[model samples]
Target: MDNHPTTFPPAEEDPAYLVFLDSLDYLPSDDVARIKAAYAYAAKAHAHQKRMSGEPYITHPLAVAGAIVEWQMDADAVCAALLHDVMEDAGACKHELAEKFGKPVAELVDGLSKLDKMEFASYQEAQAENFRKMLMAMARDLRVVLIKLADRHHNVQTMSAMRPDKRRRIAYETLEIYAPIALRLGLNKLYRELQDISFRLIYPHRAEVLAKALRAARGNRKELLTRILENIRGKLEHAGLRAEVFGREKSLYSIFRKMQEKRLSFSQVLDIYGFRVVVENVPTCYLALGALHALYKPVPGKFKDYVAIPKANGYQSLHTTLIGPYGTPVEVQIRTREMHNVAQEGVAAHWLYKDGNESSAELQIKTHKWLQSLLEMQTSDSAEFFENVKIDLFPDEVYVFTPKGKIMAMPRGATVVDFAYAVHTDVGNHCSSARINHELAPLRTELRNGDLVEIITAQNAQPNPVWLSYVKTGRARSKIRHHLRTMQNEESARLGERMLRQELLSLGVVPISIPAAAWDSLVKASGQKSLDEVYTDIGLGKRLPSVVARRLLAREDMAGDAGSNMTLAIHGTEGMAIQLAHCCQPIPGDPIIGSIKKGSGLVIHTHDCPVIRKSRSTDPQKWIDVEWEPEEGKLFDIRIRVEVKNTRGVLAQVAAAIAEAGSNIEHVAMDADPERLMTSLRFTIQVAHRTHLAAVMRGLRHIPEVARIHRERGGEA
Candidate 1:
C-alpha cells in the first residue's frame, strides 16, 4: 500500500475513463481537471491493492464517483468520492490530500473514513463513532454524506464475495441505518434500490420469492391496469389538466416488510396498486387530484394532503387511495414537476434548480437543524448515540401546530413532551403540563396531525423519571437524560469537593494553602487526569476520600494511618454518591455508621445493623463512622409492619391515620406472618426524621382494627 504506481496511463488514454470524464459536461474546465487529478492520485495510492473480486481497487473509487455524478453532485463531491478510501486503506494522509485537491475535498474524504487517534471497545462502537463524525461533517456540507451513501451503495452492489456472516451484518446495517437515513433525506429512488439489494443479500430466497410473486401479479393485472390507466388519462385530459401519469410497483423489500409488519400474506400486501401523477405546477397537481376523485370514489381516511403540510424531509404530494374499476384499491400520489424532482432525488435535488427550490432548500435547513442538535446531545457512549439517532430516522411522522399556529413535525407516536423539546430544550425541561386542543391533558399525550398544543411550564418543575418511559422522539429523550445527568454530575462534583476538603483538613492540609505542585502530584499519582476527576472517583466511592486526600501531599507530608478522620456528615441530598443504605434506613437522630460501597459513595446504616455486623467481620476497612445532619425540607423513608384485623375499611383507616400524621407512604407490601385472623401490611413511609416517624406510628396506634404495629428493624448481626 505504501508503494505508489511507478508507471500509469494518462486519464484520457483510457477509453472508459474518457467516457466518464465526458459526462462532466456540467462541470467547469478547471473542476473537471481537478476531478481527473483526484482520480490519478487515488489510482497511484491504491495501485498495489486488489479488491476481493480480484479487480483493481481503483475500480471501486471510480464506481463511487460515478454514482456521485449520477446524483448530480458538484465537482468537489465527485473528487472526494474518488479519493474517499486513499487515507484509510493507503498511506495517504489528510494533509497530503488537501494539498493536492483542496480543504473541502479533504474534509469530505476524512468524513467518510473511520475515526483515528481513538480506541473503541468493539466494531459497533467504532461504527457509531464514525457515523457521528460523518453526520457532523454532513451538516456543514451536505455532500459529505452523499459521498458516503454513494460509496456504501456501490459496496452493497459488490458484496457477493464477502463471507455469509459479514454479508448478513452489512445487510442489517444497511436496512437499519442507511436505508432509513436515505428515506429521511428524501432519496426515494436510492432508498428503494438499497433495500432491494440488501434484501437479496440477507435473504436471497425470500427476495426471489417476492420478486417472482410480484412478476406473476403484474402479468395477471397488466390488461386491467392498462385500461384503468387509459381511463384515468382520458379523464385528466378532458378536465384540461396536463398530467404525466404512470404506474409504479412497490419494491419487493417494501412488500416483504409490509407483510411482516402487518402480519399479512404476500397477496394481501401486493393488491395495493400504485401510480404517480406529475403535473406542470402546484395548482395542476390539485386539479389532477380533483379530476381523479370525480372519476372514482376515494378511500376515505386514506387521503393525505402532503402539499398543504409537507413531511419533515420536505416531501410534498397529494396522496389518496381510490376504489378503481372492479373495486380494486389504487394508491395515487400527485405532485408538480419540481416536487417530483425533490421526491425522487431528495437532498441531492438541490442541484436540480439552477437557482434554488423551496423543498430542496427546506430539506437543507431541516437537515442542518437536526444535525446541529446532536451537539447538544453530547452523549459520551457511542452505542447510546447510535441508538438515539435511530429514533430520528423515522419515516412515519405526525405534524402538529404550536400555539402560534406554526407547524412542527414529530415522530408518529411523539407526545406533548416531544413537541415541547422541539420548540426549545428549556421548554421541555420546565414543562409541567400541556393543553391539547384547548383542553388540559397529560404531558405524555400523543399528538395528532393538526392538534394545536400549548405547553405549560413551571419554574421549579424538572423532568420526572417516568417521562423516559413514554418519550418517542430522540431529541426529547436525549435532552431530558442529558439535563438530568448534568444536574446529577454537578451535584456529585460539589459533594465530592466537600468530602475532599473535609478529608484534607483531617490530614492537616488546607486546600487553599497547598502548593500547585502538590495538587499535580495528587492528579498524577492517582492516575486521574485532573483534580476534578480524582474528586469524582472519591465522590462515586471508587476511591476512599481519605486515600485520595493523602495523595495530594509528598511522602514527607503524608500522615500515618493512625491519623484521626473527621466525622463525615450526611445531608441526604447527595444524589447517587453518599446514599443512605436501604438495608437499614437510618434517619436523622438515628445512630449510624457508614460503609464504603465501591462505585457508590458511603452508605449509612444503623449502628446496630445486622448487615454491618456481618460484612465488617470480613472487610473491617470498608466500615467508617458517620453522622447525620440531614438537609432541611427533605424526607427520609422508614418501613413499618402493621398487623390489623381483617376488615373491609381497615386498609383505608390505616392510610388515613398516616396522612393525618403528615407522612406520605412511599410503598406498600404484605408479608406472611404466624398471626391468626390478621392481615400483615408493610408500609414504607417518608418522614422528616425520627420524631416525625414517632408521630406516624403514634397516629397508627389509634386505629381500632390495628392489632399491633412496629418499626421494621434489621434484627441481629
Candidate 2:
C-alpha cells in the first residue's frame, strides 16, 4: 500500500490546507506553528500511500483537518485530525507523536485509532469493541469524537471509489452510527450531509429518482416559493422586524424518509418548500413569527416552541407550519442569530475551548452529561451497550415539566422511569411510583409533551427488574441492571453463607466460629479473594458448598465423617440459593431432601420426586436429608394438571374451585387434545402445604367438566 507514487490534487482541487489555515485566522502564531508542524509530520508519514482515487493519502488527513477547522475546533483537534490515521496505517507510535507534537494531540490521535492489534471473532464484534473504545475516549476528551466525525465525513464523501459492497457497508454504518453521533453533538450540517451521502451510496437509483423528482418539484414551486418569500419579507419589514428570510429545501434523505413514513408521493408532500427566518434578537424572532402568521394562516397544532424548551442536544427554534398561496403547506423556523448558530453548529459552537467563555462551558457541560451516561452504560455487555447506545441516537423529543415546573426534555415515548433517571440515578433507583398530571400512573406510563410528572420515591425502594422492559434511556437500563446485579450478589452471598454453615454442621464443625486461619486456608485452596467471595461464588452456583465445606473440614482435620445427624431446618424464605425444585413442588409437611448442586447451593426436592429418584443412582453423594420447620402461612408453588371436557368457562370454573379451596393460582396454561375432546389445564397454584394442594386438586375434580385431575410431579404433566 505504501509503494504507490504520490498523486496530489491540484491546488484548486485540494485547498484543504489553505482552508484550514484561513479558518485559524485569529489563532496565535505559536498555535498556528504547532498545527503546521503536525501537518508536515503527517504528510511525510503518509507520503508513500495513495488513495483509490489516486490522490496522495496526505490529502485525506488535510480534508479531515479542514472539516474540523470548519467546526472552529481547537488547534489540538485539527492536529489530531491530521494524524488520526498515522498510528493505524503509517506505523507511527502515539509516544512518538507525543514527543514530536504534544501529548494532547497524541492522545486525540490515539483515541481516533482503531484497535487492529486485538483479534475479534467477527467484524461486528470488532466494530462494537472499537466503538466502545472510541466512546470511552470521547468521554475523556470531547475532541476525539469531533475529529472522528471529521474523519468519517470525509470518508463518506469520497466513498464512491470503493466497491459497491464496501461502499454500502460503510454508508450503512455512517447512517446508523456516525450520522447519529453528529446529530447528538448538535452538528446539524455534518449530520445532514452524512445522512444524505449515506442514503445516496446505499440506494443510488432511489437517490437519483428522488433528486430528479425534487428538482422537478422545485421548478414547479419556484413561483410559489418566490411569492411566499416576498410576502413574508414584506410583512417582517412592515412589522419593524429586521430578519433574514431564506427558502430552504429539505434534503433528499429527509424527503425520502417522509415519503416512506407518510406513504406520500412527491407532489403530495406539500411542506417540501420551507423557509428560515433569522432575526437579530429573541423578541424579534417571535415578532417575525407573528408577522408570518398574520400574512399566511398558521396551521393549527403544527407549531412548536422549542425556544422555551430546548431539545436534549441544546437545539432551540420556533417552528410553525403555515398555509402558503395556492393552499401549499410551508414550514418556517424562527430563531435569533445566536440560536441559529447553536442550532446549526450544535455542540461545536461551544467546543472551541480556547475561548473559555460561559457559552463554551455550558455546551461542554451539556455534552459531558451525555458522555457520563455512556460511562454509566459501560457495565452492560458489548452487544447490549451498542444496542442501548443506538436507542439514544434518535431524538424525537417531548418537553415535559416536573411537579416544580422545571422543564425536562425526553425522547418521545419515554416512560416515567426514564424521567426519574433523567432527574438523577438515585431518584430513578428509588422511584416507587409516579403521578402524571395529578393522577396515579404506572411506572411504565409513556409521558406526553407538557405532562406534569411527579416521581414518588421511597428511601428503601429499589429498581424493579420489570423496569428494564419499558425504560427507554440506556442510562436507566444500565442503572437498573447494575443495582439488580449488586443486590443479587449480596443476597447470593448471604445464602451461600447459610448453606455452607449447614454443610459444616453436618460435618460436625461450627460454621460461625470457624477460625480465620481456617477460612484463609480455604480461600487460598479455592483461589478466592475472601471468605464472602467464596460464599458468593458457591451461592451463585460457581462452586459447591459441600466442596468448600470438605476443604474447610480438611483444614481443621475434621473431614472423617461427611454425614451427620444434624439437619438444617428451612422456613421457605431462603432467597435464591435455596430453591424449591419446580419438578416436584415440595411444601411444608412433606418429606424432603436437600441436594447440594455446584454453584446453586441447596435445592429442596420432595422425597418422592422422580428427579431425585433418577439422580440417586448417578450421584447419591449429592443428596442430604432435609426437613422443613414447623412453620405455617408460607406459600409454596404446586403444579396440578387437570383434563377437562372442551367447554367454555371451564377454566374459570377450575380457577374458582382452586380459589374456593383457599389456594391462589400463580400461573395457568392449557393444552387441548382435539381428537379426545379434552383440554389439559396446567395450574401452578400457591398453597401452604401438601394437604392444601391435595384439597385444591380434589376440588378441581368435583367440577362437572373435569374428567381427571392429578398433582403434577415437577413442571410436567
Candidate 3:
C-alpha cells in the first residue's frame, strides 16, 4: 500500500508517472515523446486488466518505470520498463510494439516475456527458462535487467495480496536471484530493499520480532550515535578538513545474516550502526580517516583501504572500526561525494553518463568487462550459467598482487589456479606451479590479501582435472571446463581412430588400404561433418568402432571381407576415450572386459568386478572382449582396504609396508566407524599389474598390526 495505486489514475494525476516524467526533463524532447508514447500504448493494452490487489495493471508498469527513473536510467530503459509486461499480459506483439515504440524497446519487452505457449514439466523449469532468457537479454543490454529489477521491486511491494505458497516461492527467488543481481550491479538501495522485503515475507514472525528489537535498540542508542557523529565531525573541522558525518544503520537482512552466521543474539551484536563521512575530494577522504582515528582509539586489524583498491563492482571507501566514547565499537566509512555516488548507484552511475567526468568512462570500462564475461558464458547450459552467475553475485573480494605489482581482485578463498586464469586462459592452461609471497606453494593454495603471486608455466603443462575442485571464480571454472572438453574431444577422436584401425585389421583388411574417398563416403553415410567427427563419436561410444569399420569397408568395396568378431587392445594409457573403472581398477595382469558406455567411450573393468558382473547379466550385448597389451612399466591405480589395529604408528607401518613393496600410495582414507575396534584404511596405490597389486596386499597382510587386507571390489571397503 506504500507505493501501490488502487485505481486508473490519469497521466497527470499519477504520482509515479509524474515523477518519471520529471526525471526525463533533461532528455531531448523527441526521446521524451517516444517514452510517453510507450506508456500510452501499454496503458491501452492493459485497459481491462487488474492486479491481484485490484489496481489498474498500468500502475505496476508506472511504478516500475518510476524506479528505473530514480536510478537515472536512460530514456530507452524507462520506455522498456513501461512496456515490459505488455507482450506477456496483454497479447501485444513485438512487431507492433517495434513499429510504435522502436526496436530496442520491443526487444526488451520480448526478452522479459515468458514462454507461455510451450508447456513445461514444472513451474521451476518454466521459471528457470524465463530467467535464462532475461539474462541473455541483460548480456546484450544491461537495461533489460534494470527494468527487471524494477518489476520485481514493485511485485514484492504488493505481494501481501498473493497466496501464501506463491508468495513464499516468489520471495525466495527474489532473495536468491534478483537481490544478488542488484548488489552485483551496484544498486545497493534496491538490493537492500528487495532483501528486507523477501525476508519479511518468507519469515513474518521472525521479521516482526527483529523489527521490534531493532526499533528499541535504535531508541536506546540514539544519544550514543549522535555523540559519536558529533565527535567525528568536530575532529574533521579542527583538522581543517570539511566533511559531513552521518549515522547509517545496517539493513534488517544484513543484521539477520550476521546474527545467523555468528550465532549471536541481537543484544550481543554490537556495532550494528556505522557512520559515513562524505568529503570534498579523494585526499580529504584519507584526511577524514586520520582525523577520526586520532579522535577515537582505533581498533587494530579493523581497517581496510578500499580507496586504493576498489571492489569488483568499483566500490571505493576507507573503512575503520573504532572504540567509541563509552567503550562501544563503532565502524566508520570515509569517501568523497563522487565515490559515494558511484558506490550507491554502481553501474547505473556510469550508464547515466554525465558530461565532463572521467569516472563515467572508467566505470563504463569496468562494467563492460564484467558484462562481456557473462556473454562469453552464455554458451553454457541454463543451469550452469545460472550457477556461474550466482557465484559472481557475492564478490567477497581478496586483493592479491602480481609479481609486477598489478593488483587483481579475486573472491576470498580463491586458489592460485583462479589467479592464473584471471590473468589469462593460456597462462592458466600452461600453469604448472606457483609462488605466493616468494615461497613455493601448491596450485591449490589459498591466496591471501596483499600476497604477491608468481605463476610458473610450462608449454607442455595442462590444466589438471582436480583444479575444478579448488578454483573459485566462475570465469576460471568455465574456462577450465571448456579447455578440458576440447582436449577430451581430440583425445577421444585419436582413440576412436586407433580402435577402428584395429577392427579393420581383425577383418584381414589393411587399414592403410582404405582410401580418402571411403572416409568421405562414411562421413556422408554417418551424417557427420568430417572423418574426425565420426571418429570422435566412435571414441565417445556414441557409435561402435566395429559398426563404423564395417561401414568404411563397405564403402571401399570390401564388404565381403568384413568380420563379425573383433577384439580391441588396451595399452593402459588410452586417455579420455577409454577410462579404467575406479570401482575395479583393473591392471595389465587382470582379466579386464570393456563395456561400451553411451557418450563415454569404453569403460574397462576387472572380470570379477561386481559392477561389471551385474551389468553383464542385465545388458550382455554391451560387453566387448578386451585384452591389455604387454606395455612395460605402465602404472595402474588399484585400491586395497586394510583392517589395522587402532594403535599409534599403525598408519605409518602400513604405509611403510606398501612403499617397501615398490607401490606408490596415491590416496588414503580412514573409514568412519567409531564403534569398531579395528580401523579400516582404504588406499589407492599405483602398480604395474595385478601381480604387483597382489604382492603389495600380501606384504600388507604379513604386517603384525594388520588384522586383514584384501583388494577392494566395486568400491566396497
Candidate 2 C-alpha error for residue 667, in Å: 7.2
Q: Best-fitting candidate, measured by TM-score?
A: 1
Where does model 3 exceed 4 Å of error? 1-19, 117-121, 351-355, 494-538, 541-564, 608-611, 630-633, 638-717
Candidate 1 error regions (>4 Å) = 1-8, 11-13, 116-118, 505-514, 554-565, 608-613, 666-676, 713-717
C-alpha positional error of residue 595 in candidate 2 after TM-score superposition, expressed in Å: 7.3
User: lDDT of model 2 at residue 546?
Assistant: 67
What's the lDDT of the predicted structure labeled candidate 1?
A: 0.83
lDDT of all predictions: 0.83, 0.83, 0.83
Q: Which order, best to worst by TM-score?
A: 1, 3, 2
C-alpha lDDT (0 to 100) for residue 206 of candidate 1: 90
Worst ten in a row by lDDT for model 2: 1-10
What lDDT tens digits, residue by residue, belong to model 1 across residues 286-402? 889899999999988999999989887779999999998888899999998889988988888887565666778888888777768766664887677777888888748888888
TM-score of each: 0.92, 0.84, 0.85
| Candidate 3: 10-residue stretch with minimal lDDT | 1-10
lDDT digits (tens) for residues 1-717 of candidate 3: 012222433477778777778888767888787777778877877999999989889999988888787777777788888888888888888887777777887888888888997788888767767787888788788888888988999999898889999999999999999998888877778889999999999999999999999999889888878888788888888999888889887888888998999998888784555889999988888878878888988899999999888877777899999988768888889988778877787778875546545555576677778888877766446677777777877778899999999988899999999999889888999999999989999999998999999999999999778998888888888888888888889988997888788777877889888898988889999998988898888788898776777788774464444343667788978677789988888889888888889888889988898876777887665677789888887788888888888888899999998999999999999974677678989888999987888788888888888988878878483
Angstrom error of the Cα, residue 575, model 1: value is: 3.4
Clashing pairs in 3: none
